[model samples]
Target: MTRPHTLLLAATLLSLAACNDAAPSTADAGSLAATITDAAAATDVVTPADAALAPDDVPAPERFSYVPMGCTHRVSAPVGSTSNFRDDRSTFGAAPDPHDVHVNWPADPSSTIAFLWRTDPGTRATVVQYGLSPTALDQTAVGSVGTAGLMGNQVTAHEVHVCGLRPDTTYHYRVGGEGHWSAVQRFKTGPAPGRTDYDVRFVVAGDSRDDVSRWRQLQERAMGGMNPPDFEIFTGDAVLVGFLQGQWQSWFEGARSAMSTVPFVMVHGNHEGLSVNYLMQFAQPQSGVSSQDELYFSLDYGPVHLVVLNDTPLRSDYEGDVLGTQLAWLRADLARARANRARVPFIIATHHKPAFASSSHSDEIDTQAVRRGWAPVYDEFGVDLVLNGHEHDFELSKEVDGQGREVSGRRGTRYVVTGGAGASLTTLGAGALQPWGAHFESAHHIVEVHATMTRLELTPRRLDGTVIEAGRISLTPRAP
Candidate 1:
């Protein structure tokens, strides 16, 4: 049996040294490169700058690009801690006080904050009032409401985007429409984009389907920990059934502790079938990557340009290629990122399907399809890291190229599978390790990514507080 500590050491070494999988590594094959080249030549790619002129006669890619709305924090007397951190669990389901209060950055994180909440269907309106001081929350923001959940048990979903706020400052606010409002909560804005000298921390994990209690614990611990993450990133599978209103409620209830103060950057998983419920729920930045809903998009948080992809087959139930329109848009996005690498030096791509996993579902057709269609794009663009979920276990891969070859130095993409968040574990079968599999853990936990301009540090911690794997990748550049 591989003890947790030993597993952690092995994974860390493999990541830092850019190790390979169990199979014999090979160089980039000629055919795959040629295929990518041909695709590029054949497609009329759209750049971010030119995306706006997309003709209405033809379907233009849906995208939302953000520019920094710089602001200085108002150093008002800090609102008392009780007004900010008290648990609102007791007030849940009581009335218009709202349930499932969550935050996201659908617009500029520096000057805008997006919120989603649930209220009784009878509630007349959904609104948010926020400001620099708790007592003087005179500013008002109205939100739209929609119906969610299965037939006969629908709930009202409300979302708001509070614009024109200060950057890197704390603000107090409450949710509810008209006469009803919940307790005031606080959230801090992140640093402006293109600022690369500071440190950024974010929690990355997924597959919390059907395990609400465990998910609650993870949320409490993650938010309660010292210097909690700037935001939360779930690769996907937030709920067992994407269309189930009750499951969505359960997920929001479990995660409300952290989410109220931190924004959630979400992705779609196989479990998010049809994405009807998902589309109605949280609002994310539009990236023009997908003709579909918020299933695929991109956002810039500080210096990191994070691309969220919808790799699930649109017609089927989460089985297919990332080819066609999404791939072409992705290539264009990466090209833009590479051209402006100096401004945003770290570019990380995230999707719900894994390129490699040593679990029972490792060989799923969708995973293989994603590898075939998207891995070459990742390699060609020099994507720094690729994050994924879907497999119900933790597996971190070595820095492997499109052909599974171990690339040395600071090159190659590092892929990590962090699907252990509150999901049932998947034990590795004997001799099931692939050449790309560097570390595998069959436990429920979360992965913490500490990002700086020149380095990215990874630490996967079990729910019980055991550090299972730790590694660091340097983004340092060589002298000319």
Candidate 2:
């Protein structure tokens, strides 16, 4: 007589076989189930070859399946959550118009992605259909909808969170509901945690306010080549005024091509301020802090640990110690990342104002405050790189410690101010290049970063493909 566990395994196999054209014999099912059991107990190690297989070539058991690693799927509150709303704008027989559709990672970049789009305030459907193939979007995920008070007008913003995706895989998806849908768009997920076999690529850009033409050109160049970046890191100042709906619309229209296919990791800039408009537009991972959830957070992609902070000073009317609370959170977050440095070797921090820059804004009050408060924290945690914007120029600093002393041999934090996406260029300030400044230039450019287990390379290039400067950081092992 067969055992109960064996019978259960056989039943599961038969159910799976139903999806295929043919089912195996009873004896064959028993043999296959025993083989699967032995394989499961053998080992869980994934080899380099396994990581290199194309999405279509992955083994059947693992294809389109979720790898459980204790991830919590959380969706952000819909628009109008913080502001007063008008009447519902939905009509009885109107076609859905999904515009400004974009994607971002609100959870683990490897296993989850958040999609946001806008429609008339009256539209109500909030759904996303996705799958590995464009023709076959068999899986569906429901989301929430809310209204946003854009200037004096109201628009409905739809946000959907899709989780349990395979790492380094390309997926096609569409958003809508009630039998109306948008065109299909494709995006690739980031590499899995502790996986060093794949190279991670991304673009760093910022300060594109008031220059829609230039912004479009920069994005076209960044996403034109055969090998585009996995995602983009926008250093903020995306619009001239954060609360103005027109500016936000223009900014998204300029980034439509790049944002449609790759996730954007955003840094809140001074221009955006603390407005409900900014909060309602983008969905980001919560920082677990009540007041500052999407305002500042951290995420891991490939072997790099990225921390985004809100270094801008609080509004005069707001209460509580925003900066102090963020500092405490930073210390704890960096400690956790440092403890796991053996797996993710690089710690990169990004904010709006620069801790080290030799440009027009270098001597401003906010920039100085950011330098005084945050530079030491970065040094204490052995952060490898710091990225910033708001200078409207390009500047890269030598390795510097918390005390404003230059430390050579890659032992200190290196800062780069890459705020040349579209805003008018500004020249370096008089006597701004200090001992720690390695390079400075006033040009429209973007920084392209390529990261592997043992090496990280950053190349800043102008719109015309001219190389502004290049730098590399070698991975150093740390003790647990």
The number of the candidate with the highest lDDT is 2
**Every candidate's lDDT:** 0.66, 0.71
lDDT of 1: 0.66
- Predicted structure 1, TM vs. truth: 0.77
Q: Report the Cα lDDT for residue 110, model 2.
A: 90
Candidate 2: give the clashing pairs.
Answer: 89-122, 90-122
Clash number for each model: 9, 2
Shift of residue 32 alpha carbon in model 2, Å: 69
Off by over 4 Å in 2: 1-73, 76-95, 150-153, 316-323, 470-480
lDDT of 2 by residue, 1-480 (tens): 122223323333332221121233465345445544543432332211122222555442221112213347544442224222222233312547788899988888998888888876666677788999999999877666665432242345777777789988999999876456788999999888888788888999998977888888889888998889999999988875454566788899999879889899888776664444566678788776534658788999987899998865333211233347788888999999999888888899999889788776676666676787789999999898899988887888888998668987666888989888888888867756867788888888888988877777788888788887444334453334
C-alpha root-mean-square deviation, candidate 2: 21.0
List CA RMSD, all candidates: 14.6, 21.0
